[model samples]
Target: FYSELLHIIGLVETKVGGKRLIERNSEGQRHSGTILEDTIIHLDSLDKISRLSKAFIYGETHEERLFNVALGLNITWINRILFLKLLEAQLITYHKGDKSYAFLNLNRIREYDDLNRLFFQVLAVKHEIRNDDVKKLFEKVPYLNSSLFEPTEIEHQTLFISNLKDEKTIPALSNTVLKDEQGKKRTGSLSTLAYLFEFLNAYDFSSEGSEAIQEENKTLINASVLGLIFEKINGYKDGSFFTPGMITMYMCRETLRKTVVQKFNDLKGWSCVEFDELYNKIEDKKEANEIVNSIKICDPAVGSGHFLVSALNELIAIKSDLKILQDKDGKLLKFYDVEVENDEMIVTDEEGHLFEYNPK
Candidate 1:
């Protein structure tokens, strides 16, 4: 199944003139397909391309393919660099031999202890402030406003910073030293923060080229995929696996469909088994609005929040469909507003009422 999908993706790419690569079957037969010009494909389709390429060329299993794809695009490497940079700047500290640096008690840092915010500050100062200028920036750590160091347009800066801030608590190597048999000191590859930053800066995460495949679908590379990649790279001890978007979507849809049916049927005193039947039974727009708004979704073990995101998108879609039943006044129903707080999706109605979307 994986290999067949890979052949199709290669064919799709070639059809769109994305690459000169030719698609072939396992039996060494060339394969071809047609895709309409200017048609936008989703990121999931491209992910299949990455997965199949790894599996066919490297003999990687589905799990291995997912890990490799995640590692290639993960931004957690940046977090490690930022953490070490903060330590070098004396803005934070850890006990000797402690692999983790605790930000909860950093006295010098007065601003929000958000690692994402700190990274933005670093990017902002990377070019404009240097040498002795950095000393001044760190000297007033707690009072340092990242906004003061904005380097580009507000929209661009916001997108880049938000992307970086998607995941929390990336695995990083401890700065502790080791000695060989000859008593020579040895350190982890990531111990040197400067070298790591230099390497990371070479890859332009914000460039159109970096995200071209995803942008073709009017989306960006999944942050959850990147987070999983970082976990694999850092050798995360937990046995957690990255759930594919397709699986997440299916699970969310089925779960939400059942829940919505039950809730609506119970509310309207109707015994309907189908979602469409439930929708048709509920003639009151206000009642429908209440039912939609009251629905809360949670993913208890949310990692990278793929499930929650899928649920949110599904809910928004369901709400839009329900809007068709709205009267002329109900047509003024404001579009759903969504925000990401602490990596969870927070959706609200036009009246500014917040719906809970807890993913812990």
Candidate 2:
């Protein structure tokens, strides 16, 4: 993805007086495809990119700065896209698996312009005030009041998604889940946008823990897993990735469990060491909740924020262990048990059914 995006940035630069030299001896035959080597550019030398390079990148040379800028832009775009992918999954889950609200597919967003509008005009704006052109085009895609939908500082100084040509194809990754019709792995290239949407579509982004799986086993990609992935990918330049989720979960449980115990012991004369001990001693759920709320956590690494998410899950699981996890009504979730297993939070009933969040 980063490889293709390097060429995209260069292509975008060409609109604003940036020069591009199609490599004469390039591996890619002069086809209608997007790839990095196809369009070689001095992006850092360009005025627009230079401003961004100066503002964000700490690299010394033009080549260094150019690569960093392209990478940052590509990652930012991918994150936003992934967020929407999850959002689409959520909306579909809410509507009884209805596909009407799904906007990430090529059918709804046929080109980059549609995606651009989805970002800046449709999701970014309130539904009532959106342009009729896109509002009708994307039915039931509600206005998600999220910063992801808003244009970033980088986008303000550069081209939007609509600026990139959509008819381009890019080489598929060698290690790919995409397969060919001969019941084998696909080795050839694929249309850029088509591949992205289809790749995401193949996975099940089901937040609902209660959903049953059928014959076709699908990979479940949730927010926490996505967070781990994004953090790992973003930290590739730094040679750092997420402290494995198991370790994170264990660390959080140990730290938070001890901290909670200490706070209770200090405040009261209760010499509780285990979370289970506190369950019997605590009288008021509100007081216990306030105590838990007082605890603050910070992951100094701050890579993809997976650590913080782990801490959050740990807190919830701790509360569940103490039998104090409650709903908006102050009624305990006695019917369910929330546990952190394999670094993933699972909510199940006494009968071992996963708790599905169906607000509908």
- Candidate achieving the largest lDDT: 2
Residue pairs with backbone overlap in model 1: 70-229, 71-229, 110-142
TM-score of each candidate? Answer: 0.38, 0.82
Candidate 1 Cα outliers beyond 4 Å, as residue runs = 1-220, 230-235, 324-360
Which ten residues in a row are the worst by lDDT in model 2?
A: 13-22
Q: Give each model's clash number.
A: 3, 0
Overall lDDT per candidate, in order of appearance: 0.41, 0.69
| Residues 186-249 of candidate 1: C-alpha lDDT, one tens digit per residue | 3333212222332232232222112124322322222444444433323332334566656776
Q: Which residue pairs collide in model 2, if any?
A: none
For 2-95, candidate 2 gives per-residue lDDT tens digits of 3233332222211222322221223443333442221223233345556664544536775555455555656677788888888889988888
In angstroms, the error of model 1 at 272 is 2.1
Quality of model 2 by C-alpha lDDT? 0.69
